[model samples]
Target chain A: MATITTTRDGVPRAASQPTRGRPDRGFGTIGGYIGRTVLALFFAFPIIFMFASSLKPDNQIFADLSSLRAFLPVGDISMDNYKAVFDTVPAWRFLANSIGVSLLTVVLGVLVNSLAAFALSRMRWRGRGFVLAAIIATLVVPFETFALPLLWWVNKLPWLVMQNGQPMWTLGWLDSYQVQIIPFIANAFSIYLYYSYFSTIPKELDEAARIDGASWFRIYRSIIMPLAGPATATVAILTFLPAWNQFLWPLMAVQSENLRPVMVGVQYFFQLDVAWGPMMAYASLITIPVLALFLSFQRAFIGSIASSGVKG
Target chain B: MSRFMIERRGTAVLAGVATAALALSACGVASTSSGGSAGELTLWTHNAGNPAELGVINQIVADYNASQSKYTVKLQAFPQESYNDAVVAAATAKKLPCVLDADAPTVPNWAYAGYLTPLDLPQDLVSKQLKSTLGNYQGKLYSIGMYDAALGLFARKSALEAAGVRIATVDNPWTAQEFADALAKIKADGKYQYAFDLGTGDSGTEWWTYGYSPFLQSFGGDLIDRNGYKTAGGVLNGDAALKWASWFQGLVKNGYTPAKSSTDAFADFVNGKSAMVWSGIWHSGNLSKLGADGIVMPPPDFGNGPKIGGGSWQWAVSSTCGEKAAAMDYITFSLNKKYLAEMAEKQNVIPATEEAAAMVDGWQPGGAKRFFLDESAKYAMIRPPTPGYPFLTTTFAKAAQDIIAGGDPKTILDQAVSDIDADLKANNHYGF
Candidate 1:
């Protein structure tokens, strides 16, 4: 066994380490690897089962539930369910709508929320604390309590439309893409997240920029935003998820199938005889994109959570 | 950080917001309308994902639009699961389409809430429809359906024969005792995972009432007293209902059925996991996979004779529809025997009229699907035609779920009755 020694910094150091060519194979490290692998598998089993079941027939899916075959694509498998998904719903159209809506919401949300956060955190203004408190307070009011009233309000709003090559005003925001994206752009939780992260940046940076005759917007755009990558990533993901998974609002607000998102498409398979296989296929199809997005932003998401003291 | 750079950035931000606003404004489609231009009538149906039914509906609209120059009918389809929420939301916004299809039990509530208008189709044409297909609340017809559905006990002939269970018929359904014996015999065979699949895995409250309430009614209990529609006190918690609660729970306790079966019980039955499945008419198509071995039997006569939940999706004109006469004209035109037969054939539901049934392949007299029509005509019991049905259904479903999960049936039933009565009283007996 290599002896461990304390360094001047009070950190443990392996004084006489094992051969440099090979890594340590200690039991603790091995146990840690086992634990991590188990945790990864525990979280991955549902996704694995979903993907596996999506390729099999409905009867075969039930038949394999008793054993490990459920999570493995080992039985008679095919892309038939995926094909059926296209037949059952306009899968590509719904996917495209969701992606566009989610991306736009993320971009707009980050810009709008970060600006609100910067004003609350860096700029000196009267009633700033009350404004921030009010924004945070709205988080406690459940979306469902105001969903109906919001629906009524959106239906009465006026929109600009083109008729016969002339601009005309129309009433109601029903059956539109903007109705889905705009209402979700100014999220309260996102504003709070950006505020917390912005508060951590040293005030001296803003002071130095100000001493050099920088405007507030200039300071926000140049100095503050560049250092808010983690916060931006966190807010982008937070906004994207709800935007992608919107079902009830879109179902009520949007009447056209072409305007619907992927989440609303899931209901298409819930016919009299629910197409379970096709539903799983649609789920897997929609989930893969979100999984990829989260994976790409995994590091920054965790860093933001840690640095900003956000629980999740 | 200079003044010019700051001004440029500010200008860019303002320009970006303006562009985004313009883009968003341009994204809006023409607002949905019940009646537009005095000649266009908008109709909505809950058939978005169902191509077969939607195809027929689209064909009807196309034919109607082609057959007339005065008005054009436009169809918008929504998925069935969330269709109600959409309609309710639209109703709240006072933007309901000219015509929409609503589930049967909801027609009363919709009419009571002033969401539906009394249909103005020809009385002679309406008389030809199945009585259960008519949505009548407070002595006025508010809706009509092209097709209705039925329920049956689907099983394999081979399994029944091997288990020595006598095949049941519409005339002489198995009594409660005989049905219990059959389940016991099937379980004793030990060849299947469960002797019966009650489809309890369907967690929808509507399913609970539609699929199981018939058994409660057969046991001489009901969700509410029909005479007054004011309360569920005696009927829902009475002795007959107690017996139903016990027997329903007993099926699971006796291991005749899983407490919570697979989500797709018909799939499990088709895979030989369950010897029998209590399912709806929608599942009859999949029975063809069993070839001649598959059989459908009437539900057992628990005590009040065999019963099945009735009523299905029915069409109605929204109260806010500006073109009520025009919408009624289109609705009446679509009710022709030709369209009805097409719906019955393509959707595999029981035709709403004998004349329509005569036109369909398997729905004519002595046809393979004729039994479903006979069952619907004889044994079908439409849920209480009262505006309180929504609340009643939810209460009964919760009570039934609790009983299935092994709660004391009497306590749960009593609580359900109390809750239901309180709601009825609160709403002034739902305008009785």
Candidate 2:
């Protein structure tokens, strides 16, 4: 989370007061409004286009973009596509699965990242820099390179193999919720995000808490975690949203229809005989929630960026 | 406000719930068989849901259940694309329902692995028709395409006329050379730029290999030597390879066709852009979407050539299939004379039996359907049921692209034989 006062052209802030006269502080100037309008459109266009396409009829969807006016078929405002989506794919089940995994990932990620970041920032641990560097170094190796080995290792954990004809180390983690969450549970980016914020969190607070006879764990649970809301919120949004949309790894992991999450289940929409109408409707159904959340909380997220002192 | 207590309570509750839910969601113990306890047998089908065909299949299953006291088949339909991947995963867990379907190609892989069970059939049925058409591995009948297939021409009629070529009769069907000329004409007239480009790389090679395997068979060359007594084609490079390589290269070099669509570019012909696509007879549904007016005919012969290519689909019981008798019963019911008629009427499939074809009552969709039947006596070449089909696809695919890439035709054919041998050698390792 890096906070900086963007140049006036970067984010369009509406005139604080609709122009009566020019203010002494260069407020509400023409340059300001033009900059604001241009910036707003950049973010809004993709969202607006997605919404419009969601409303489009299937036959017209494949038509040329230039013929958009003619493309939207004249028909009843139909929910058939949406209905078809529900009939074929278990949408609510996938949604529930996605929400469950994403929130779980967020909670676990925030704890692991913030605690590690807190210790590195405030405690006097030996080889602290080395530990942090080693952990951060993992970010260079792409997650996909480790995916197969990790999956196999977790699924057929050698310890789980009943070596003495008595089961020893049985994790039995294949195609499970843990399989989906564990690989992504402790994130490098989340730790880095927290570390950068925690470093700037006024060391005086930790010092005062220690003077009050607080233990390190107590300080973390009480003083540090409370003040790091802005960073936590930023991490939560970034981490959980991607987890919600993750399809491939989960698809590889879960085979049972009952176990499939929203992203994996929705893939059934593109059958060899996929009806174009239902396909669009199914796609729209899955994306709508994430898009809505982005729009509503976008301002709060922007504010968190500023407060995290990242740009400082 | 007790803010600390509230935050702590919320976090603890959330973490507790998450742990419980995750445990529940993660563990998957496939359900035990509800069959063999009585007459309940679970069946799985990968159907795109042609209601007429579905009705026929269901009716047969119903008849079997009615006729016997031992089994009631429970059918579950899956969308075709997900079925194979899902079934294989299920097979590992012993969760596959009694019946399954796959593309004509994959049945052999499953059979070779001993995942499938062979069904008892009248030797006459297996020998005269299917013994050669179904894919085999080592020395076993794994599966057979449920129907016969043949490569034919599908040309968007309006697109051809726009390019100033009107194909009036099947008798005037173009040759390998004439087909290239039409492609050139389509591009030159700007009606289309050789709209059908077979996908390049591995798949692109396969397109020419599969799509044009017939060329070799027509020219009296074979992909496998077949060793005469129950064997496949070609000791090494054969005349069929040269015939197809030359034709494929001519198309590639002329730049008359798109060099990059799909290994199977069935979509381009249906897109109303390509003047002609060399494809199987099932492309009617694809062409109908663009506009229903199109013509289908046999591939243009290069001087009264040999019947080079035909395709087949087969079915076999899986090892997991409980009550092999019931499974055989189901297959029998599905392939009974009435069900064969349903395939012809519903899928517009070529019949595997003369009796089935008679029942179809003008089942062919267009001139293409008629062309296939008219030439059934002349040039329908069935792909060899051997370990060699995949190798043939690979070898010819390379030859096809080399011709496009400006390689000498004869040399390209020679090189492909070696490449194919390398692949054959690799497959034999059976390394753990």
* Interface RMSD, one decimal, each candidate: 4.3, 7.8
Candidate 1 residues lying further than 4 Å off, grouped into runs, are A1-25, B1-37
Candidate 2 chain B, which ten residues in sequence have the lowest lDDT sum? B28-37
Clash count of each predicted structure? 0, 30
Q: lDDT per residue, candidate 2, B1-432, as tens digits? A: 257987999999999999976755554433234222246666655653234345656776787788877788776554455556555655554545665554555565566555677666555555534232455555666555456665566777776677666573445656666666667667777766564444342243434656666666655566655553122225335555566666666666677666555323554445444567766665556656766566665666665563535554466677876677777666666666666666767776666665666667674434335555555435665555444455656666666666767788777767776676566566762211
Query: Would candidate 2 be rated incorrect, acceptable, medium or high by CAPRI criteria?
Result: incorrect
